[model samples]
Target: MTYSKTWQGFYELLDTVYRTGRPFAARALPIRLGDEEADRAIDLLYQPLRDGEGAVTGIFVGGYDVTEQVRSQAALRDSEDRYRTLLDSLDVGFCILEMKFDEADRAIDYRIAEANPAFARQTGADVAGLWVSEFAPDLERHWFDTYGRVALTGEPIHFENQADVFGRWFDVRALRIGEPAQAKVAVFFSDISDRKRMEEALRVLNASLEAQVAERTAERDQIWQASTDLFCVATLDGRLASLNPAWTTLLGWGEGELLGRPFLDFVHPDDVAATTAAAAGLARGEPQPNFENRYRHRDGSYRWLSWNAVPRNGRIYATVRDVTAVRAQAAALAEVEEALRQSQKMEAVGQLTGGVAHDFNNLLTIIRSSVDFLRRPELPEARKRRYLDAVSDTVDRAAKLTGQLLAFARRQALSPAVFDVGEKVRGVADMVDTVTGARVRVVVAVPDHPCFVRADLSQFETALINMAVNARDAMDGEGTLTLTLTCGTAMPPIRGHAGSQNAFAAISLADTGPGVPPDLIGRIFEPFFTTKEVGRGTGLGLSQVFGFAKQSGGDVDVTSSPGRGATFTLYLPEAPAALEADDRSAAAASVSPIGAGESVLVVEDNIEVGRFCTQILQDLGYRTTWATNAEEALERLGPDGAGFDVVFSDVVMPGMGGLALAHELRRRMPTLPVVLASGYSHVLAQDDAHGFELLHKPYSAEQLGHILRRVTRPGRPRRTA
Candidate 1:
């Protein structure tokens, strides 16, 4: 063939081909089949020629009838390129494994085209065209068997297999690359070590979390069971659903008795309304801050209950506190406080009476003595009768006035005796209905058996009546009044210690009425303190009970809150059968006249008292001396004066009180008899009878005579008779 290329251009093209070392093709624009043809056909291709030294020599137009062969070669090259690209780009380890049946059906051969980076890194060896048994001997059986199955059956196999290669792992699949047993089987493998590590880590974390939850659950159970506060779960319908040990213990009920039962079954009837309201609020998801109510115990006694709860897990989880003991203590404390306040008021009143009595006794002494001298039997009988009548009138007026003062002071001369308390409770109950009118129901639950206490019968009845009256006032003649009398072991004194433990009776007066006024409730027991109109009450009822109870080794208590009625309880020492029945004979009889040869010393700050005492002593056949105060008495008993046989001194003189003078006088005349005279009971100091004779003043000449005879006469017992 002839070519148009110049010699230099031809050599240049040849150099280019030789330098690049790649195939190149070119084509002409068109070809014409004319009759005249050239001596050669041109080949539009570039090629390089090499010389003996292996250097590129020249471009050559070496034409031949090789069109068919050229097309075939080009096609082969294109397929080879595609195959090489696939081998390089694949991620799975592609090994063209050949199964073999040797001496045993085990040994295998591996003629890999090329392995990916994954397979190369796993084995740490370039393993193309390697025997399968030599490269990985342990995998010979499994690999050949899997490869054989897939290659022969034209099926794909997916399974897990392990390899002890770099970063050891499990591989997933084996499949045939081509059709039939003659073809290479592809075994695809991946390093799954990282995935396995992640799974193991997750398992350990789950175990730890489960352990933590178990521990927390155990702790919660322990708290629920061991706590003193009752822990419980209730349904929305206010049924007792579940409870801990504390609930049963506190309520004194068995588990069977409480579970699935309505909570209201155990509530105090009077408190049910408020409890129902609180439960309703809780059901509506209201956060009730510590709800308070009362629950009836198994013994039919009511106890206070306080509770707080939360709604969670479709149930009400709650903590209940049996505040009965605390409530009782608080009630007892309030009662004690009320009693103490009342007692203080009574003491204050007594102090006022004492001051008045100190002055009044002197005046009474003068009058009594003048009246006594007028009846000396030296005058006519008619005139003497008139004088005696006048004396009688004076005595009657004085007795009435003194009685009022004693009532106000709460320390009248009471003769306490062993008797049934149930009668008094009933007596008060009978009057309660009359006083409270038809609007109130009065129930007297007095015990049929004797519930006994040692209290003055009159005072006891009066206290009961007072409480009933107060209840009537509170109810405004409406609602129910319950007077309950029961006996029990002695409780600690409602106030201070009332001796040691003693048999006691509890008289409870409960009223369903308007509660005490919130503001004035605390001060109701103050002297002259009243909730009624001026004519209705003197306000000394509670105060008198307070003093009388304490003095008799007992206490009085009361409770009232807003919107709730009032309850008053009296706790008194039970009279013992062994003790003398309150010495009733002592309550009777007037003061006795003085016997012969008793010398008396009269000490007073008031002029009228001193002079009268002198006259009475002389009239009673006793030598008498008078002194204005303790100082004057001490001087009169000094070396200049002959000492009297007995010293009669008035407490509360100008310079010193009677106790101090007694201390002073007893220093010199320790054995000499001294009697302290006062108009009122001794409410000044803790003890008015501290190692001396105490004479309640406002006594007649006859009383003066008795005091002297009782002290001065030998082998004589002390008595007013």
Candidate 2:
């Protein structure tokens, strides 16, 4: 019997049995057979040995070595500790699902037997040891089936599916873990929601890109098919590669016939060189500016083609437009313009000849009769004076008739001065009252404020009277005439003349009378072109108004329709009130009377007229010199005519005209005074008379004497037209 630290527990058990006369057992009791031997485990049992009387007796022990069994249990416990650590540390959700079956052996539901910590984190619920139906009542049945099949068949499956009940996608691998009858499956799963969303976004983006590509292709094709201009692509050497549908529509050439052919082959022979040059430039990476050439059509005719081309990637893209109609229109316009000019020339000639023949004959008749009566030797002095006066009056009438013609032609000498238009219009209205008769009422609408214009005062008054007379006649002497004066107004376009923004005065004369007929309004201003019966009008009234307006740097506009009456508006450039004040002061200054012995140079082309002019100057007590032409007048002036007080020359003549002579004389002697006289000069009509004193032909002796005296005065400034 031995007792030591290693076998102390076994000794205690054996001692208890012996002291109490009881038996006991001790399993897995530790003991050492020897100090050097390895530790061993033993199972020990104690029992009492007694006689038949059953009194206490000696003890008996029995037991076996359990070292191997104890070692095996220790190894198993260590393995289980490592397995639990792996499950707790894993990121993937781990669970064992026990699938339940119905009477038909079909998978009905699943119970979660075991689950790791990550399983609750992934599924958002701690579902271990619970039936899946209790937590996710609406979970899809396929989940049960999928795991059930793995459990029933002892097979493993890997899959990714969305758990809609939890709004999460899972990547899962499930395998049967126990026996087939157990219906348990071990599942490994991970939440793949972020990856799944990214994949879906990529798929949608791909679909959008495809749709955009298809839409752009459709749009480009539509433009190509529906365009009106020819569109084509060509090689650097001018061979056609592709052409839009417009090419066939415009030139009658099919794509099959034109493709792969040099485009210049269809060009007109005259246009080939230009087309080649343009194509060469485009090939040099220089875009071609728009150019025009001719192309041969299917009918063997040529069409004008305007081409614009650009270069890209060694190819030329061009757009061509057919301009044949445009070219034809331009040609026709030129012809129409030329014909119109000729017709206007002929019409003017006819009007001038007829008017002259009719009016001049009457003037000549009076002159002829006056001459015959003076031929009578027995005529009384009073009778002779009467005939002489008749001759003088007839000459005056003939001169006035010629002046009217010049005025109608817009070729009259104008003496422009600044004056208030409102005042002048009011004064003319008084005269119009008598002219229009008692049957017609005159209404004047003039602003109290003065409106000024720089124009010929006499011509302005004459224009007003002419228009008033015209209105009166149109009204047959029995309608209202309204005269309105407006200042600071712009001129609108009239009779094809462009408008202006400069300040202007508009004097409008409106009449309540039958308006001018539409068809005749265009020719109403033509000379001798009257709407009235032959004896009633000479048709020069409105023409004079037109001429006056243009010569004064303005325009006239007429508005009328059938039964709406007529309004004639005269637009004149407005003049500042300061100019009006200055002109008034100058006009107030007295003009010096005719200077005695003032020498005058009279240049006249007509022999008799020249004689009459010199005679009139001589009778006015002035020394006179006469030249038949402007060239002779210059010669007579001797380069510097120191003796002459003034030079009076006619405007229109052969070779050098009077205006040229005046300009030359002025250049030679800047201080020399010059007076020009013209009946009808185109130069004077189109432009102002170059700031020289001008006298219309058929002048009275008083007019001639007055102009010479004023210009030749010692201290007076040179008088201007």
Candidate 2 C-alpha lDDT tens digits along 95-116: 8788899877789999998888
lDDT of 1 by residue, 303-410 (tens): 687776655435665656565666777889999999998998688778556645753575477568758778686878887777777666666656544543464455
Predictions in order: lDDT: 0.63, 0.78
Model 2 lowest lDDT segment of ten: 198-207
Top candidate, metric TM-score: 2
Q: What is the C-alpha RMSD of each candidate to the true structure, in Å?
A: 34.6, 28.7
- Which consecutive 10 residues in model 1 have the weakest lDDT in total? 198-207
lDDT of 2: 0.78
Residue 675, model 1, lDDT: 83
